[model samples]
Target: MDLPRHHTIRESSHRILDPFTDAQLATLGRALHLTPGTTLLDLACGKGELLCTWARDHGTVGTGVDLSTVFVAAARERAASLGVEVTFVQGDASGYVAESAVDIASCVGATWIGGGVVGTLDLLGRSLRPGGIALVGEPFWRTDPPEAALAIGDFVTLPALVEQTRDAGWDLVEMVLADEASWDRYVAAQWLNVRRFLDENPDDELAPALRHELSTAPLEYVTHQRPYLGWGVFALVRRP
Candidate 1:
């Protein structure tokens, strides 16, 4: 029903919970060419940055669904602080569908909620209007990794991801990719967050676990995840 406290602590300061930076997110929003009053349904919308920012910048309204209660509360607070009226529901996003077809439907970074890419697209399709845009944020393998490294991540190559979209009867429209610097920033930030949390709460039960993660995560990132992992947000339209 809620995310583990340690997970929230590790991402304590993150607004966009993925590899995307604020500038990259803004670029993606702009690329969508969202008009005023466009309706969006954002699944796994961590911290509601996309909804709140789009509302403030593009005048689009949206609802965000996430399983993390901490993120849901933060998302609500973000919308309020931004003076944008958007709803953030703390629940399983995969099970929720809009009452009416939404102009845009997105499942970003949490595709496992629908099993995988194809299933996630099917879930998103349930909420999208005909010809509506589907924004899917996913990770792919930038380079082939060793079997042990591959065990840590499950992702296809970028070309294979594109093929998955086409195979699912969607036309690829546009995509925004995360560069190496952005990936480094994101992973490094998480390490810092975990370190800060441990520093402030050394006696806490989760501190040891966090400390262990911090000890190994940086080297792991530099060795396998960083060099081999690729992330992107793809825009697609369901084909007739």
Candidate 2:
């Protein structure tokens, strides 16, 4: 989807859209060696949850850039509310450059930077200093990706994702699989926001379509796919 619609949908349901869990966040924090002074660049940072949380807990300095102006605004608001000084910019994360090299560069759940994992790492590397960590949050099919799986949205298998990263000069530092409970939380939380949106704007043009999509999504997700799909965080570091 384009920026306008994508931002609208995400903004409408950012609260419901649980992007990560406690374990996943802890894993990333540990992998990045998050500290008061550690700096990270979050590419394609959707609403800047990862960066904002890290900044608040770890006292780290970070920035998140996304193409969605609405998300950028929300992220900025989140940072301010948390009293963290994270800079959220509305820009193209695919090519956004930092003023200085960073210690950790991540593109969680957004591999559009390099068109895939390999390319995303290459992009992260360009912005990292020596010995920096590159974290990628991705979804991996729990089993082999069937031909019919192509009907599903943007995702690749675990093996293929690992292969691509290794081939791109990275070593897996850590990995944490998101349990089914986490997935349930992530999906279920969004329904609240969708419901709220529908309640507030009953006459909205897209409300019907959004409601239909959400109503059927869980069934399609659990029955048709959840049994065979996995979500995880992969933290990799550039080799010296």
Candidate 3:
């Protein structure tokens, strides 16, 4: 029902949980051409940054669902702080559905909640109006990994991703890929957050694990993840 404490601690300072910078997110929003009063249903909506920002910037109304109680609370607070009205529910996003079809449905960087990309798209489709947009944020392999055993299993190449979306009955309309800088910022920020948590809670039971993560994550990210992984938010629509 709630995220593990360690996960929350590691991402405590993140506004946007994905590897998307504010500018990139804004660009995606613009690409969507979201009009005022557009409805958005965001699943696994960590901290509600996308909903809150879209609400404030585009006048879109939305509901966000997440399993992390901490993140849900932060999302609510973020909505309030932005003076935007957004409903953030603390629950499993996989089982949640909108009361009615929505203009935009998104499940960013948490597709595993619905099993994988195909299942996640099916899940998101349940809340999307016919012809409405679906925004799926996922990672792809930038290049073949040097060590096949160490490669991330969930990620495929960009072409494979597009083909998968097509096979699932959606057309890829637009996309915003995260550059190296964005990836570094996103991953590096988590290290800092984890380190800060460890510093402030040296006696905590999870300190050892957090300390290990803080120590090793940067090198692992830069060496293995940075060059190999590409993350992006894709705009898709159901094909007739």
**On residues 1-240, what C-alpha lDDT tens digit does candidate 1 reach at each position?**
788898799789899899999999999999999899999999999899999999999999989999999999999999999999999999998788999999999998899989998899999999999999999999999878778679767789999999989999999999999989999888899999999998899999998888999999999888888888899999999999
Ranking by lDDT: 1, 3, 2
Which parts of model 2 have CA positions greater than 4 angstroms off?
6-19, 145-148
lDDT for 112 in candidate 3 is: 94
- Model 1 Cα displacement at 10 (Å)? 1.0
The runs of at least 3 residues in candidate 1 whose Cα sits more than 4 Å from the true structure, single-residue gaps closed, are: none
Give me candidate 1's TM-score against the actual structure.
0.98
lDDT over C-alpha atoms for residue 34 of model 3: 90
- By descending TM-score, how would the candidates be arranged? 1, 3, 2
C-alpha-based local distance difference test score of model 1: 0.92
- Per-candidate TM-scores read 0.98, 0.89, 0.97
lDDT minimum window of 10 residues, candidate 1: 145-154
Top of the candidates by lDDT: 1
Worst 10 residues of 2 by lDDT: 10-19
Count of clashes, each model: 0, 1, 0
